[model samples]
Target: MVLQSNVRPGLTQGLIALMAAACGFAVANVYLNQTLLVDIAGTFGAAEAEAGIVTTLTQVGYALGNLLIVPLGDIFERRRLILALLGVVSLSLVSAALSGSLTWLIVSNFCLGLTTVIPQIIVPLAAGMADERNRGKVLGTVAIGLVCGILGARLVSGLVDSLWGWRSMYWISFGCMLLLALLIRLRFPVSKGTASLPYRRLLLSLGPLFMKEDVLRRSCLSQGMIFGSFSVFFTTIGFLLQAPPYSYSSAVVGLVGLVGIGGAIATPIIGRVIDRKGASFANKMCMLAALISFLIAVTAGHWLPALILAAFLLTVGTQANQVACQANIFSLSASARSRLNGLYMVCTFLGGALGSYLGVWAWTRWHWTGVCICGMVMIAAGMSAALGTKNGGNSHKR
Candidate 1:
């Protein structure tokens, strides 16, 4: 595993934990708005459907960042790029907290998403630093933080909103980003980028890179669809829980995220399975889990326990599938990992943006039933794409 001359030593368990923490803190910013959509809409006297745009725009900004900013990881010093983005995201969170109108909040949230792509940057950095023999295990450990941040964002935001107000959550997140930046500055080692390509060519390379890599294409499609379903579930679940048959408080909705810990606990084990059984097998298993989750959710409209069970399964599926897909793509190119990651994330978040929009659309019409059906359709499509691929036998070779 050759690396750039200035690349730091291989990951320590402590460094891996810090990378995981950074990924968690940075990625949490993108999701803080999910559970707060209802409170935000009420505060601004906007319709639920109108407020849904906040989630969609955040995802759109993330997708754009993956396209425009993440590829820079290949050209610039990664720690510097990461810390700079953290500073911008901190300011964005403050802007969100101080937003005077829904429009203002929406714009600020988009900025937050645009700058909150530190997790994506960190993943490639970690992957590059890890030993090939245990790369899956390292990635899975880091993914635990990613998973926790994503699910924990809902839990934290919901409680903060319930106790203080929706805006308070942003204030807390702002402080978190500031603290995260300082820790990263102290703890992370400097690693120069491998690629020295001109900026324009760096961006242009994404097209050819995507076109040339079969594993990259399949991984993108499978993960995009699964993440789309993930977006659909989280985006609308709060609204459903707050309505009839449940009439739950925001705090209760947040607690549902805690229930997802069952899934988080399984990620390391999935990583080991990927190491032993291969990413293709893990991908298929994850898709099946996701499909069954939606199937159960379709009948969970009136049952809290069933809903909880479904959420757990969905979390496991989405998080495991992410590990599998990322492991698959990162194995393809040592030098182009960042660019490949950028293309892959761009598609994944585009799917998320679409899911956020579609989830709201379905909720406004057919409610929870509609959201479940949308999720099922996405998982089914992802399964079809994964099954169509012929890479299953060779996926473990790397």
Candidate 2:
């Protein structure tokens, strides 16, 4: 079946920005707990390593949701699916805010992840609607929203936690999700399903999709590794900052997310690069930026400036690499975009879950040095995947 957009002949700037904002707001729920990990640990009288499980479990749930729920986008009306997910996530945030114990919070957060698949669904929707000429740029615009939500979650959560408490952050997120759901209902066009396959067939197709598409495979492997490294740095950085020489507060540590705004600002330009120079070229450059980020992060234990610089580079790398990979896979099959996205993101967040675990584990045993080693190894593995793929001449043709 041929997919169609009912909105208008071309996507307007206002609508694009709205979609971007929606993506940012939806994805922020997943990372809100990162900056508050230290405070959460103190609240529950649990070790920091134990507190880190909140982040790990959230990613694991996200991966599972991507695998199981995101594929439904292709079989159901997208606007309804997205709104239903938003409602579920809002309830999860409330559950998180009211948690009386760490175990309760962990379970709430996992539920939060399970319902937070809205952004993944929206991304493919936007990509499918865009013309090939502007697909990369549009994807980048949406990516900017996703990146900001990710980085901004830390900043907002930290500030809210410092001002009120960690629980207050969840309350704020719940409000934000409700507001976003209202906006989506009012503003988003009704987009119908593109495929006629049964739910079971949709689920069954994902494995063959992964096995059949080379671009999908490479994009998944490389982006998954980079996302793992991205998770490693973020999951443990709060712990590092709250202790040791700097001894900064959660709010102060969250300022590091502001540094990442530089990366977000650069995403559209990277999107254009992917459009002109191809995903292969952009992928290589992004991997190099990540490599440098971790190298600088090794010195972050003693120097504040190094940590800030590393954060900026890593954000640029991960965000840009995502735009590249999405641009590559969305080009493969219009009818299968959501399924392709689901498969790609399942791998990406699984990598993130592993990185979250390793980040805490490394921090517990080897300290900052160990964390840096783990991040570098993940980046190296990603680089190997990108280097191994034969360069596609242009991403639009992929």
Per-residue lDDT over 86-165 for candidate 2, one digit per residue giving the tens place of the 0 to 100 score? 98999999999999999999999999998899889999988877888778888888888998899999999999999999
TM-score of each: 0.96, 0.96
- For model 1, residues 1-398, the per-residue Cα lDDT tens digits are 34323224656777888888888878888898999999999999999999999999999999999999999999899999998998899899989999999999999989988888898999999888877766778888899999899989999999999999999999999889889988999989897889999999999999999999888888899999999999999999999899987888898899986788677777888888888888888888999999999888997656888888999999999998998888889988889888999999999999999999999999999998999999999988889878865555444544
Per-residue lDDT, model 2, residue 66, is: 95
Q: Given candidate 1, what's the lDDT at residue 352?
A: 93
How far does residue 36 in candidate 1 sit from its true spot (Å)? 0.6
Model 2, position 8: C-alpha lDDT score = 31
Q: Give the CA lDDT, 0 to 100, for residue 197 in model 2.
A: 98
Candidate 1: where are CA atoms >4 Å away? 1-9, 391-398
Over 4 Å off in model 2, which ranges? 1-10, 393-398
Checking candidate 2 for backbone clashes, the offending pairs are none
Measured on C-alpha atoms, candidate 2 has an lDDT of 0.89
